[model samples]
Target: MRRPLLSEALLDTIRSRAGGYDASNTFPHEDLADLTAAGYLRAFVPVERGGAGLTLREVAREQMRLAAAAPATALAVNMHLVVTGLAAIQADRGETALDFVLDDAARGEVYAFGNSEAGNDLVMFDSRTRAEPQADGSYRYTGTKIFTSLSPVWTRLATFGRDDTDPDAPLLVHAVVARDAEGIEVLDDWDVLGMRATQSCTTVLTGVRAPADRVHRRLPAGPSGDLFMFSLFAAFEILLAAVYTGIGRRAVELGVAASHRRTSMKNGGRTYAQDPDIRWKVAEAAIVQDGVEIQVESLARDVDELVDHGPLWFPKLVGIKVRAVEGARYVVDQALRVSGGASYGSSGELGRLYRDVLAGIFHPSDEESAHATVANAYLGPLER
Candidate 1:
């Protein structure tokens, strides 16, 4: 009897506006406003802090529902959720280091993940950006981050850079930089093939100063078993999987509806739902979508319940992300196939879904890296 996170009317409004936003290649400012008014931005902040206090699992389910309505909006919001969710998770476990993040979110500040670099394959483990220590304890970062979602309106950007000041003890400095801080430039160069509403523009940082207090962690250049790292991976991977799973679910629904609406010429104008081949395609897509949904929900639940997977945590996280993304891609492709030639049109919902789902592969834990992580976890490192 619990109420839905996104009401049907709000979802319908968001869905109706999606095509216009995607077609115009503009950020969904209206969608953001609507979501913000619904308190979606602070879903993870503790209720005592004037927020929803939703668990990660609840938020993940909400994200799936949002993505089904407007994927770009959902994906962009996912970045903010990742930051806030990380802080909430850490705080829930008695770590107060990131309590400021939750506080800021509760106070109406928006955050974005500005950690992605153009050529850095190591992801959170390493950074191509340079972090120089200042006379005080603060650090100045200089580098460019690509695919920075919520670029247009994010107030704080969570990013990291490498500090080689001490070559023998190099560190990856993680910090949250205020968007209006001096020496930070957000470029309007987000033109892309998909996820147009994300406005994930390129961010150029030239000595952007992060006050010492805002600088969170300084871990070694490579992977480390830090709580912050675990929180980040858990929130990011699970929520990201949720978004793609939602996309696959929507695609399956679209395919089924299309089958019922389209008539087959060869069978006396009978609906495609009567065509065995179309039905089979719909069934196949539904099966894959079902598995992806289950995997995402299960992983989110485990994280919420604090299930001890130990070393397998990373493998499980990356595995679900890869599976959900790939499965979504397949489901969208199948949906496009069964929807007939009209779906090939640029304005068609399936066409947009097809484009948006492609952005999944480009997210962190790419297929190559996910495989390598799993391989190392199972077979051990390759002879050092």
Candidate 2:
């Protein structure tokens, strides 16, 4: 299939100042502006709501290309898209959120998802982040969530937590909190190894009142109420795959360009690419990326099919996500290895690729619950 133009454009921008960006640890604001102008936000948002309304499969493909160009930016943007998809799914809340997102895009308002909590028992969903119901059905949210990406620039946040009462609610509500809410603070505490531009700072919630409409499903809002956990969770896999693919491609491309200039060990004058061993290594990187693309494509298709069928095929999505993340790591590692010491050099492109790929392992996207879903799908049917 032909590559998308968005990927090429973003890559061009990234390449222009990649070394400087990484060295300075700066967000690709220009690239983000371009992406926004290019209607990338609408790429995953619903078409009915002024977005491109691309299918699940198409969304994956598009995001893969975008991520390959700038993984950190792509990933940070995925946070918004995930929440947008969640907003798209809720009939009552979905339309309203989409309208606001469209306005934000029109007004150039950036957003990010803030879901993880600090010191609140994430396991039990104890979510110390409490939201007390107030008069007129509004809620006053209080708690601190760390690792909130793209703040200051982010005008909005999509957060998840249990209600003041009824932890066993039929659904888990995802609320949208404005940045200027009465008692919220955006803390700068992100010290990540890679994808540094993500700006994953901490966002504190203290006595911030969110109206009922802005509050998606209230506490006791069961887990199954939001398919976004499954949808964008699946889409994030595509993003992960794309990030490594881009890194691998850049590494191989740079390696090929540099290898020809290097003297070969086998012969006094032969260059690295001229030697069989180095040529094989470079070729292997290409082969690995090709394989990963196929896997990502298959997963996207499975997800799209599930969207049409509904519920029964969720297991396949989870499995594909696990495999995609694994594929991304493997692909990038091979590319880095083939590129050799140049990849590790402070000035080289490969060094950045190494850091970006490492971020995948630490991302909360690869949680144990998702892994268990894959296991359950494969093993749960055995007793039957």
Candidate 3:
């Protein structure tokens, strides 16, 4: 694997500040600045665009490494990476629609994903936001978006909405809106149980404007079969799974360390590492974490190699995400068990990890959606 851009010292600083950030309900500005200085934000852009030119698979490995240092920071950075990755994926496939993103990244502009909305079950297929077309060929987007990661620092937000102005082209309009532009408001309300350092606040768009030139795609509303959708799903799911896998790996390591340190009074001063039950629990967590790691690497490699699985691709991608998330939860639980009651303190590292792992359940390709996608792949569509 290629060397990671984030150094151990930088990662340690980020990790050290994570608890304070979470406690204060603040964003990790220092961590972001360090990462930006490292040019980690442009890792997905082509080398010609002044980036590291890393492939999706390589970037996934890097993300996993970063997550092990600080999961919330990794999760927040994942949004920017996903948007840039989508642009890279399309550009590599001969699409000029997202060239502006590459150009902007090369110029050191930060991007954020503002695609999520409350109660939008169709996900990328449709939208609850309204996209009103202008006479000058621009668009006005109006809606509220939830979980807007990097809310405080993004220079541009890649957003989407529905445009039913043209009957034949009832479209899902995609565009990039400037962060400081009119009609955009980032509410300071991001308190949560975990991943608090992300500061994914609620963003209200009264009528944010995107110039005609900034608009990229206008797919027919509802479950698009376009390259944009493919890139979005593939990059988002794989990168997300990588984060959880890293969390699981960290949890296993912590469990082992705790076992080696704690002594078993009942066993005549023997350490917990010599206790059968503690050893079993640690082994169980390791086994599950290893499985998730392998799956993350495999699917990421498939994406980079363009290995065609056809209809099975979506199921496989979603399946890997679900497996990674659920596996992380289980592994973390077992680790806590092996580490004993000391891990239960809310301020402890293990305690924070438990909270961070729970946020995985809320990410895209959720448990229900993943299972449905897999079922549809093997059993065909349900009868209407």
- Which candidate leads the pack in TM-score? 1
Q: Per-residue CA lDDT of candidate 3, range 249-305, in tens?
A: 889989999999999889999999999988888888888999889889999888888
RMSD of each: 1.0, 3.8, 1.2
Better of 2 and 3 by lDDT: 3
Error of 2 at 183 (Å): 1.1
lDDT for model 2, please. 0.63
Give the range where candidate 3 is weakest over 10 consecutive residues by summed lDDT: 222-231
Against the unseen true structure, what C-alpha lDDT does each candidate score? 0.93, 0.63, 0.90
Give the per-residue Cα lDDT of candidate 3 at 150. Answer: 94
TM-score of each: 0.98, 0.83, 0.98
**Tens-digit lDDT track for model 2 on 78-166?**
77766654444332333353455545544455668776775543322346677677788777777787767676478877776556455
**Which candidate order results from sorting by lDDT in descending order?**
1, 3, 2
Candidate 1 C-alpha lDDT tens digits along 9-107: 999999999999999999999999999999999899998998988998899989889999999999999999999999987887788989999999999
Query: CA shift at 114, candidate 3, in angstroms?
Result: 0.5
Q: With candidate 1 superimposed using the best TM-score fit, by how many Å does residue 146's alpha carbon deviate from the native?
A: 0.7
lDDT of 1: 0.93
